[model samples]
Target chain A: MSDTAQAARAVIGDSEFDRDTAVTLREPGVYGIDLSAGWTIINAVNGGYLLSVLGRALADALPHSDPFTISAHYLTASQPGPAVVRTDVVRTGRTLSTGQASLFQYDDEGREVERIRVLASYGDLDSLPDDVRTSVKPPSFPPMEQCFGPEDGPAPVSGSSAIAERLMLKLDPATLGWALGSPSGKGEMRAWFGLADGRDADPLSLLLAVDALPPTAFEIGLSGWVPTVELTVHVRSRPAPGPLRVSITTRNLAGGFLEEDAEVWDSADRLVAQSRQLARVRVG
Target chain B: MSDTAQAARAVIGDSEFDRDTAVTLREPGVYGIDLSAGWTIINAVNGGYLLSVLGRALADALPHSDPFTISAHYLTASQPGPAVVRTDVVRTGRTLSTGQASLFQYDDEGREVERIRVLASYGDLDSLPDDVRTSVKPPSFPPMEQCFGPEDGPAPVSGSSAIAERLMLKLDPATLGWALGSPSGKGEMRAWFGLADGRDADPLSLLLAVDALPPTAFEIGLSGWVPTVELTVHVRSRPAPGPLRVSITTRNLAGGFLEEDAEVWDSADRLVAQSRQLARVRVG
Candidate 1:
């Protein structure tokens, strides 16, 4: 319906995930990209997808390659367009390098908008100690046929959103309060996530998968635009193939403030990424 | 030993927790306080105390008073001094007000040292729906007398650290890897934490309690000072009076990086606060 949305779809269809998330070098610490709006929820883009874009830039500058950890502070809501990413290497050690990446965009008046500042660590996951292996058990799911997704038919409630077209989110209808028209009255959402284009979710793609689900706050009877204030994602293991099963829970919803904890498990049933965020419960 | 440390102890000793955690409002969005070093872990003060200090400042500027969620990024190590806290209102909505606070101190060069930035939410905990109650089971503990703390006698191996002199941390002993001279190899630590001065632990105090345990990495036989890269804390309920039970687990220790998740339960056995961190395995 909009020119930007049309452009986003074109860019996404024309490029692969590596290219869709690509950042071109602009000197040493500066990088730039024309962000596609294909992953937006209404007007705001998904937080994890934004972080993946920034993480890609930060990871490239580090000696080691894998993004071990990423903490993103959403300074302001941003839209699709040309954005600049600047990286500042804070601490470099033998095993990890900590860096801060700030994404900026210019307003119509040409004033710069500081959208996000991501604090991240890049290291070699392959080098981790395989001897000391332990994990929080991955959550179980019902039969795949019982789940709802683009494959099931078409997006019903979120059909108009760009992300619905870009991501294949098979939500467990038991927790889909919006679809059932009866809130679960609990703060939880479970879904199986993968790219609509069938691209394997690497650590970077796993970042986007964390935020791909509809806000779990809906299950608690809080209907609104749940904007993230700060999000911290921890990459646990190299994800296995197939759809990553995810569980997002909001344990405390007090005074319109809630925290969402999302655990992403790969098809092999191993935990891949763990994310927790602090957000205000916006009741629209 | 230092004047700032002495000042911190006096302030902490003289007031009740409510007053101790209260920040003096100098102006709108500006807060000032004489920070205490009584909660230091070796040379670097405990991350939770710093977070509590910053949380106090941000909560003061907000319309709602309780800090339901806090995610802090420690940019650099700080010391006891007159810390200046500045809060920036990021998002103000019907039920939540998300604000960012930066705590700054002047270094010996008279230059400003931005030690930490805290993203926090202030809201009414009483407004939470009581009917939808659930929690992960709290860990069990042996008799209080069987645990280890300063009052129990000597510190054993950790006694050399100044933090041992400052707080009372009673470990379960079953996972006290360093003290037992045998690593559990399970990557876990369980303990009971309370203020040393006999003060009841409040929400702010609960922040400190989360990081007060011995590094769980030590249980897996990883030695050294593990510095937290980023920490996200979720306060579920106003803690009940008495010592809080805690369980710390390190699921994956890889490539010189590890994650520690800490869950806290109040005396009444309610989940009070939960925290997880990404840290560099700094083996000194």
Candidate 2:
């Protein structure tokens, strides 16, 4: 193998997230990956986790190391299995490199199926200007010790949520009432996020962190899986080594769809990422 | 000419906005248009106005008439002149039709220059469920008679803004402090929006309304034109026939970039659209 390919293959960390999202360089723009069943939300895999896999491949193909902006359209549900990622380098500028990635899987009949399409711009976060001016405050959360999660309590809802086990999500008690059949009806959720395997969050992993919580629709007493139609995440900066504070809010729910917006602040209370997605929801 | 082609060519309205954004069907997936000089902010046309032209073309290319979601990456500044919009129908489902459009203009040497690339999904807004649930409130503004604008006062800053004449913008007195060389430093702007020609705002025109204000960064005392890198708009519903309420805010300013989020509500107090964009800002 070429030295570049060797470097790409050897960069996989020992963490479960790193291993699951690792990509094997099959060619210059083609990559091979296996979607981990451990990250399944129920029967299907998490859209953000799938985005991570595609992001890993794009990172390898591009000149930059960090994903500054990623816009993904979820065409359909992605299954946990072997898949292929095709990357196209759209533009490589001095400070930013724009690219596109399409993740595909094979069916039982050997027919290839495209799962998600992503357009992203990558740049080195360290090379950015050190000026940070935030006019908006981060969402308030309870002490980390006071928060609860799947590891400390029963699952939020009854289903096969393997992701709840892999992700360290501590939900704010105020937003956790939906588990007891009494929702807050506020269309908001706050959580503290980390990895079960003790891996630190970075720009790439922040992709998964942005979508790691249950749908905010649950706070309004809505039931069933909220399938994301399109998700756009803006990774503002690298994070500090600690649990991340996550706040999600839904402003409008209509037209058989709902929009969810999320903001993530790092341990140092810096805004690390912002995301918005439109999901399928039923008024029931 | 065929009936469909004739209908497409004859749909142009007498309003200036309709005349500026009107498209001629050149082929199955091709459209011809002229970017309006009347919408120029300083040297280049407004990013949102450019998007409106693309939305008009996409509306004709798809089965559905209303654009529910539009994600556009402004590759470079588009000039006021002739341009071509190339549309690609990605997928046509029962409820939505997803497509992509690339706006191009020829250079002086006759080379095609790609300006913006957009991905949008079209749907029938009237067919959406009537069950509207909004957890967020619209931004407060003074009475229409109390609001001020370019027609009522001096221009916001010393520059050529033809858009100020074409767009009936009523800036709240609180947010208008930026115009007096003294900024609010809050990174927020609220305005009442309408068209000078009495053109009613619809789903397609809402694309322009979401971006029709001075950059929120201006309220923070930042100077220079903020060039949008990427803009995404989610049109939630068709607007009522009246002036639109627009609120723009910027939460983070770092990495020589700033993020702007916008919300537009109709006179009926319904959330008509929401948008988020990342733009290049010099922190001078």
Candidate 3:
């Protein structure tokens, strides 16, 4: 349609995820982002998808490539439209590099609105020590064939979540009560996350995998609109190039807010990433 | 003592916890910090105590007083000395205020070094809905009297931890093996934390409480030095005055790194705060 769109597609590749989160450098520190309409969670874009878009820009601008820790505060709900990402390199150390990225969009009134602010550290994940010791066992679920695969069709939980279209998510049937009108009364969700186009997951895409599940509170019968306020992701290691096993658990909910903790294990049964997020909840 | 120290003490009050975390306004965006020698974990200042010092400045600079969510990345080890804190108010919204604060100390070469960088969201915790629904149970511990009280004497696990002197911590005997010759092979620690001076626990001090316990890895026989790389704290509610029950658990350790998750429950048995931290480990 436009030269910028064609150019971004050329650089970002053919995958829907890659094409949607693709960023084009506008200047030394500015990046032009075209948010895709195919990644909405309801009326707004998914916070995790928004984070990946910002992460891509940070990976390019910073000296280090992989993000060890990234923290983002969502200021407002973002829509599918044109936005700009501005990154500032905070510190470049021997092992880790810290940076900040902010996404801004224009309001209908033609005013610049800041959508999200992120602080992150980037380093090569492969450079980390190749050893693992875990006190917690990997989550137990039925084999990939036993769970409800994405091919079974879409679950219309969110009115218009185009995100359900791009990413293929397989949920454990035991925890799928929230979508069947009879919530299981448990504040937990376990699923397998991957791309429909068969694109392998990398450290950048794992950012999305962490927040890709339905709200954990939904299973507990508090099916109100949950908006993420802040999210922090710790990328421990690179994924093993297959669908990721993801589990999100909510332990506490108070003061109209709740905390969701997520752990993702790769196909090789290794813990790849962990995340903790806080969101505002409306109790019905 | 310098005038700045005296003035800071005068403004911060008589509590040892308050005096150490005191902040004095030096300019519009900068506050002076006098790191006390009493909060060292081993050779460096405690990461949680350092976060509180920064939080105090953020509380004074931002429009909101209580920190809803705060995330900090440790760049370098900090020593007992004078450091300056620079805060930037990113956005002031109707419900939440977002800001960033960086703590800087002068290195031996006279160059300014950023010891820690933080991004936080502040809000009125009192304004939140007074409702609680928890899927997870609060950690149970023996009565405070049964645990190893601070009045009994100091545990010489850390050669020089003045923090143990300022904060009266009572460790659950079951988890105190690391302090003795034998370290249990479990990666968890539980303790009751309070101020020796009888100062009550507040939202700001809760930041310190989350990290007051010894590293959880120690309990697992990994007695090596563990330094925090990134920490995120979500203040769920205001604490009821009294000692706080704290527990730290490490579930995963990989690539010379580990994740420590902590939960703090108030005297009223309400979940007050929760934190997740990632740290670097040197295996011996």
Candidate 4:
């Protein structure tokens, strides 16, 4: 095997392949391979991998102590395909640092492909008014244990077709978990999220995993599934090093495009990163 | 009149006022006016205007020459809406100089309205390749003399529709003319535009005027129109100071969204700027 492949295998020992990490790989950066033809690819590179590789790079570049949050994430892909990725360091000041990146990918020939850009920053946390509060609170949902555990709910639909299916995923309507996250994770993520798959896991893992969910949700309301042209993510806050709950509230779908704006909250209800995506929907 | 209004009128001048220009002034930024209600508000600023402001700012900040071309432009906007603009300075060395800009917008209140970042520098132009060519060639349409005047086009379906009806109004095919501006005014632009009230003009005037053409060209087709959430433009090469020609082209439109990519080429067929936009399609 190639050195890269060997190293990847070494990192992914037998014990490391848990159900949660089964879909994800650690090398070439932490990536999720959609084994099936859905070809949904997710990666955890530069520390946190949501969508924006640039954002992830910036987050990776920041000092652990600096407070940085991903305020927003977006991406669009067209033409030659794949997608090209580029990053820019807007300003790397002592207290506040800003950076941006764009991904461009072409088809076999060097023709234009998809283009994605991400903006991110690291700095001191802003002080909120004493009386300030979020207008929308995270949803109260049952833990993945009670909702989708192997013994609790139906097995997740598997195979390539599973990528195109909607898991009827929804936040538990009864108990809204408190949002909580690490000091650095600050943007709009503190909320609640329920996967179509019934796995309960770490907030960081959930954060990385949920990034793949938007495109799937976008396909739910469409006549047929729409593939993602590109996915860009920005990490605003790091979840408290544990379980994180977030609610997917607003979904704006127009034209042949779909954008899902989710409020990701920590277990303590603190907002983390705000996530959104430009999904291309395909109708039969 | 508001200070903004007074300033706009003074800068624009009165020449049988173009309603579209007036709309732009009233709604100065990217966002358009809400014609449904009597309130005329500039919802969002255009990406091009933002780039101009930021580009000028960056150029003035850096020790550079008077004129320069943009190397790249990146932008992102959301539904319900907010947007951010970013630009980058490719190189500021002695020879040819380049820069880029991107804009980002959001829909949430507490979230950012829009972010605009620019990259630019000054340099000598001698080092650049003498035979650079553009893939998109300018269209050889007739001049304004042979085409219908702006007044000959269609009028606003409703005087109160915030929707830009002028873009939808078709002109006599012969009305095709070069957009007047820089000596190489090469790019894509079409107009008989304005309340459909036939008026004929050159390219620069069109640039200042067509800013009102929302990004609906991809969906309804050029013959039809739709509202644009955001507009992005990259000025690669400025035409010689005069009228230029723009060949309109639609790249792709899917789901309920559309993207129109236009190449503005000079009379000599040299490319000047690349323009593209994402528009939200209104559905029944």
Q: Between which residue pairs do clashes occur in model 2?
A: none
Highest DockQ against the true fold, candidate: 3
What is candidate 1's local distance difference test score? 0.75
- lDDT tens digits, residues B1-284, model 2? 11222232222265677888999999998999988888888777988889999999999999999988888877767999999999988778888888888899998899998888887878899998788888777877899899888767565542357887677788888887788888899889899998766677988789999888988888888888788878889999999988899999899998888888999999999999999998888545
Tens-digit lDDT track of model 2 for A106-125: 98899888888787878899
lDDT of 4: 0.35
Number of the candidate with higher lDDT, 2 or 4: 2
True lDDT of residue A271, candidate 3: 87
What's the DockQ for every one of the candidates?
0.29, 0.67, 0.74, 0.02
Per-residue lDDT tens digits of candidate 1, residues A100-218? Answer: 78889998899878888776777777777654354467777876678887546543657768877767678888887666678788788899787766666788887888788878877
Arrange candidates by DockQ, descending. Answer: 3, 2, 1, 4
- The digit string of per-residue lDDT tens for model 1 on B150-238 reads 55654464665565655557888788756667888887888887665556677667777888788887888778889887787877777
Q: Estimate each model's TM-score.
A: 0.78, 0.93, 0.92, 0.39
Q: Who wins the TM-score comparison?
A: 2
Report RMSD for candidate 4: 18.7
Please write out the lDDT profile of model 3 over residues A1-284, one tens digit for every residue: 22232343222246677888889999997999889888787677989999999999999999999888899999988989999999998889888898999999999898889999999988888888777888787889888777774446566644356677666688888888888788898888999888766777888888999998889888988876888889999999899877889999998887889998999999998888999999989656
- Show what share of the native A-B interface contacts model 1 retains: 0.24
Full ranking by TM-score: 2, 3, 1, 4
